[model samples]
Target: MELHFMGTGAGMPSKERNVTSICLNMNEERGTMWMFDCGEGTQHQILRTSLKLGRLEKLFITHLHGDHLYGLPGVLTSRSNHGAETHLDLYGPAGLRAFVETALRVSEAFLGYTYTIHEVEEGVVFEDEQVRVLATKLEHRIESFGYRIEEKEKPGRLCHEKLKALGIPPGPQYAQIKRGEDITLTDGSRLKSADFLEAPIPGRQVVILGDTRVLNKTIAFSKNADVLVHEATFGQEREALARKYYHATAAQAAHIASEAKAATLILTHISSRYQHGEEQTLLKEAKEQFENTHLARDFWYFSIPRKTASHS
Candidate 1:
C-alpha cells in the first residue's frame, strides 16, 4: 500500500501545509481510495489534483476537531454534484453524525449520495477477512482516536521451475503449488506444493495516529507499520510545549517509530513555524534513529503493489 499526503499541517492551514489529510491506496482490486482525516479545504486540495471524489470509498477519521473535520461537508457535497454513484462510509468518534448533520443543516448544503457514519470507539472499528482496522484511545483533550490498518497476509509465490521439473503441466498445478498443498497424481505419486513455493512476502501495515502526546498509544498502533504517519506539531526544542499541548515533536515522533519497529516513518501534521526547507531537518532528525524516514507533502500519490493471483 501507498499513501498520498493531501494535507500535512496542524490546527490551522499553512502556506506550505494545509491540515491533516492523507489518501491511502490499497489493493488495486478495490478500485477505490481510503482517506485519513479531512481538514478544512481538503476538497480544494483535491481540486488541484486528479483525485476523484467518487473514488473515496472509506474514511477513517481520527477525531472531530474542526481542523480535521471541517472539510467533510464540502467533500460530501462535491460527490453529489459530481454524480458519484458509490457508497461512502465514515468511521470516527461519537457525535460524528451530529457534527455532519449540523454542518450540512447549518450550511444548507445538499448531497445526493448514500452515506453511512459509524461513531467508533476504542476497538476493532472495521474488519473484513482481507483487511481490518482497529482503533485506540489517545491522550488528546478530546476523545481522539488512532487507527491501525492491517491487511491480510498474502500467499507465497509459486516457484514455477520446481513445478515444471516435477513433470506437472503449468495449468491447475500452479494453483495448488501456491496453495501449499500436495497434489496426488492419478499414478499415485504425491507432489508437495511447498517444494515449489517460496516464502510469502508479508502485506504492508499502516498506522495513523491522531493529535496526541502518548508515546505508548502511538507505539501500539505503529508496531511493524510499513508507514507510520504521526504528528510532529512541535520542534525538538519545544518538546515540553508539545507535551503541554498534547501534541508531539519531531524527535518524539521518530522515537515512537523507532520503538514500534516501523519500516518507515513519515512525519506529518507539521507546524507552519518550520519552513518548507526545514522539513529536511525533520527528516534528518527522524533518520538518525530510523533509517527509512520520509516526509509527506500535499498532492502526492502512491501505488500499492498487487498481491498473489488467487484461484484458491
Candidate 2:
C-alpha cells in the first residue's frame, strides 16, 4: 500500500501545495485507489499526477468543511467525463449521505456510475482478504473522523527444500502443506504443515488523522502505528488561534504522535500562510517533539509494505 498526497495545504491552496487530498494505492484486485478529503481544485491538482480516475472505488470524507470536501462534486463529475464507469462508495459522518446526494441532485449532474453513501458511525468501515480499516471520531467542530488501517496477519511461507527432503514431489500434496494443511503421505503417515512453514509475521499499522484538535482518543487509536498522518494547520506560536479554530498546531501534532508511539509522523494539512520557502519553522516545531517527523507536500507517496494475507 502507498499513500500519495494530491493536496497537502489546509484552508486554501498555495503555489507549493493544493488543498487536502490523499490517494492510497492498494492495487488492482482490492481497488486501484482510496481517496481522502477532496479539497477545492483537487481534480486540477490530480492532473499533475498519473492517477487513474476509473479505479477510484472509495472516497472517505473526514469532515464537512469546504476546505476539506469542496472538490468532491467536481471530481465525481470529472471522473464520469474521464471514463469512470465503476460504482463508487462514499463513507463519512452523519449528514454525509444527504450532503453528497443533495449536491448531485440539486446540480442535476448525470453520472454514469452509481454511488452508495454510508454514514460512518465507528468500527470497521472496509475490509477484505488483505486489510481492515477502522474509523474513530476525532475532536473537531464538525463530526470529523480519523482512520486506523491495519494490515491483517498473514500466512507463513512454505519451505520447498523441506518438502524435497521428505521425498514429497512438487504436486498437490506439497501445495496443501504449503497452505498449512495436514495431509496423509504415501506411507500413510500424516505430514504436519508446521514443519514446512515459517512463523507468521505481523502486519503494518497506519493511522490517519483529519482536521481536528489533538485528543487522547486520537492518540490511543494511533498507538505504535508504523506511520501516523496528522494535521498541522499552524506553527507552535499560533496555539491559541489553532484552538479557536478547532485545529492543531505543529507542536501539538508532534506531541500526539509521540504519545501514540508512532514510528513516523507525517504532518499534513499545512496552512497557506506558510510560503513556498517558509516551511522550515513548521518542520522545526514538530521535530522538537518528535524526531521522525516529516512535513507533507503535494504528490508525496508512502508505500506501506504488504504482508502475506491470512488464509486461515
The most accurate candidate by TM-score is 2
Candidate 2, residue 45: the lDDT equals 79
Ten residues in sequence with the least summed lDDT for candidate 2: 303-312
Candidate 2 lDDT over residue span 1-312, tens digit each: 788899999888878988899988777436678898889998887888888877898899898888888899999999898888899999888888777888889999989988899889789999987788899988888889998888766558788898888888899987788667899976899889988887776788988888898888888899989889999999988889899998999899899899989988999998888885677799899999999998889988887765554445
Cα distance off (Å), candidate 2, residue 32: 1.4
The local distance difference test score of each candidate is 0.82, 0.86
Per-prediction TM-score to the true structure, in the order listed:
0.87, 0.93
Record all residue pairs in model 1 with backbone atoms less than 3 Å apart, i.e. clashing.
Answer: none
Q: Write model 1 residue lDDT over 45-69, tens digit each, in one string.
A: 9889777778888988898898899
Please, what's the RMSD in Å of model 1?
3.5
Candidate 2 segments whose C-alpha is farther than 4 A from its true place? 28-31, 306-312
How far does residue 26 in candidate 1 sit from its true spot (Å)?
Answer: 2.6
Clashes of each: 0, 0
